[model samples]
Target: MYETEDIAVVILNWNGQDLLEIFLPSVLKYSGDAKIYVADNASTDKSVDFVRSYFPSVHVIQNSENGGYAKGYNDALQKVTEPLLCLLNSDIEVTNNWLNPIIDVFNADENTAIIQPKILDYKQKTHFEYAGAAGGFIDKYGYPYCRGRIFNAIEEDNSQYNDIKDIFWASGACLFIRNSVFKKLKGFDVSYFAHMEEIDLCWRAFNSNYTTKYVGTSTVYHIGGATLKNSSPKKTYLNFRNSLFTLVKNTDSNLFIRTIIRMLLDGIAGIRFVLQFKPQHFVAILKAHGSLYLNLGRLIKERKLLPNRSNYYNTNSIVWSYFIKKRRKF
Candidate 1:
């Protein structure tokens, strides 16, 4: 069985001293004997100093430059020797007794390499968060959705998904994985920089015949978009760009057909945004496609390196399902 000390709660920070001040206490109070780390991404503020001054017991790994999420964690986690790594976000407030269920699941299944807890919104408390509501799932066209959330629709908690289950990807907000598995996957692709890197890593694990799971019994409240707001055009750009990067790198077969369909749908969404007067978001999509084209050769090279498995996705198109069929809640 995995002990509490085996888990490292590593939070990536970047100019978020206020977030650490508010949320770090609850983590210390509830995290049992697990090692807590503040992986500061070279924040210019007093975030590093404050953690050292106040929460001295919390270890600090000072990264040279802000490598965003993917490279920040990649650099910081190299110093951690623990068996389990919990890549907790700086903006999340973890609940009491969150580690026990995760440890139980880890000891129960060796093949389960990654685990994500049920993420609720810190603001609403009763509603599921947008980033990761329950477990996460993806469609054939690389669209991601969750049990309690699909697109912008969020579901209220009613003890419906409070059970251990398999999932496609775990949210980066509070993701857990075996250290060995993480190293085997070589951590998140630094190319992602931010947004959907976890899904790419999870897809890599899935391709390598490893499992990702959702332990709903363990819970955390995430203040979604604390660093990057969901409505920001930059967020739109990264989500769109990184998603194409993920799909190209991990899809099972028919790369050309799948990518063409995905891009066509993205075009439709861009047109919709234009109709809605959200021109910036439309431009973000265009920029996203442009990035994909520039990186396509690299993605193809990377894709050839990983193992491909059939039946990795369930739904054909989450866009058609959520927008046309109006199936809001999963």
Candidate 2:
């Protein structure tokens, strides 16, 4: 029961006409007084016009070019003046009092900067979506894992993760944060474009002494990868490239070195795909590394801005825990 009508819900749309039609109606139904903004990323499919025609009350910003995920949301965020800001995907459908609990969590804690809701797959209902499940966590080497997803293992959302806990990062799919904190952090890094930009932002928040939490009370159903399915080459490229970029920008020198070693080992894991003549995996890896090399100067410049100068996790500990020892998936 936040008295102030201060939440701004920002959804980024790019060729998501079908999802917009289904998701927007439910959002407007459940979200009481939150202002809504749909940022269209230059979709040739006329998604902008469709949203305007159907949802006249929703503010629509039509971009001339596809600015990717982070940039598209950044564009919309600029217009947001509300104290609370929610960066939701256009593919999400809300049920119950989904927005209120998140607002309550932030209201309860003055230091809490960002919070995420429990996310389930819209069609499956029981299973967690690949985008985010309970909440996201980070390994010692800066690799991100979540309660419901571990290296692509999406679990059933069985209310097992109902307890609230501090998290390393919240999924960008349905994230909420204080507008002032968002502005201080300067929003999402445009260099990331998409994929892992939220994790990078969370890492910065942690460095700046702000806490992020997972509020299981609030929930939403997500149509995972409506924008970035595995079959799409461009999506594959962004995931790989941005994952690497986030690691480089956030981790200190020692952790960065360990990440490089872990990446080499991970590359070996894809050898089977290469052997099976699956060229996309190899192409994704090649393009990712190639892009990193080309953007070395930019990455270095970004790295200098991180608050901490020394690696927090010990190298030997990470190697013994994550590397060297392999556990079987039962």
Candidate 3:
């Protein structure tokens, strides 16, 4: 077991006053010895003042303008001095003993750089929330799938993924990472303003030879879509755009080719959106690819600095093992 006193919990709040009221109390009650920091992204609702007034001990950082999600946390993380840092969304509530298990995993294994808790919905207790359902996995095609989420499919938690295991990525909704390792990786890539930024960070950890894990013993409740409001046009754009950038920035040549092939297949899936008159989905896909091509020169320069450039894994192997034979219900 880990000592809880060494952990610092950091939350980024936009215009979520209602969520802040519900979320802060549970965090204060359950997080033993964890200092709380609320980074307000220029919320017009007076969220910073509210937090400061109600929770005097909590540190509140008020930005001048609305910085996107990744940048908001990046700013707050700079001030965190604890051994472990918990990056949580404002729309989450922790249950009993939620913090210790994740801290224990980090304490137990020095190699474990990032750890995430099992997250459930606040109202529907048995259902897995959309943000990060029981940790995330990536297929060889660079497509990311969560234990309870496949593409657009989100399943109920059902205690099916309660066992602890190494994961490809942890949800930014409630991710825990060692401060030292976070510093080593330099935190989230700012190019990705919000969506898929965590995946990019985790991919970097994988390439850096560190492990990311899902610790099932810890549990929290999430009011999913608080930030993006599911399927919003801007959200869809960021998800597609950043995922494409993540593939380009991180993948080695062999996997890069495979990822491109799979992306082409996934792009074909967008044809149905066009046929059905869902112009936003089609536009999101095209814009993502278009942005990538537009920045091809910059991406090439970024790819050159990756440390393990030659250790690319096979996309076919990932597809057959994780997506096909496993039939793991995403």
Best by TM-score: 1
Candidates ranked by TM-score: 1, 3, 2
Q: What digit string (tens of lDDT, one per residue) describes model 3 on residues 102-177?
A: 7777778889999989988887878887778888877666777788866555678777888889888999999999
RMSD of 1: 0.6
- Clashes (backbone N, CA, C under 3 Å), per candidate, total 0, 0, 0
Local accuracy of candidate 2 as per-residue lDDT tens digits, 74-158? 8777877888888999999998788878888887898999999999999899987777788887665655677787666678877
- Candidate 1's TM-score reads 0.99
Stretches of candidate 2 off by over 4 Å are 1-4, 309-330
Which has the higher TM-score value, candidate number 1 or candidate number 2? 1
lDDT of 1 by residue, 150-188 (tens): 999999999899999999999999999999999989999
Q: How accurate is candidate 3 locally (lDDT)?
A: 0.81
Q: Provide C-alpha RMSD values for all models, in order.
A: 0.6, 2.8, 2.5
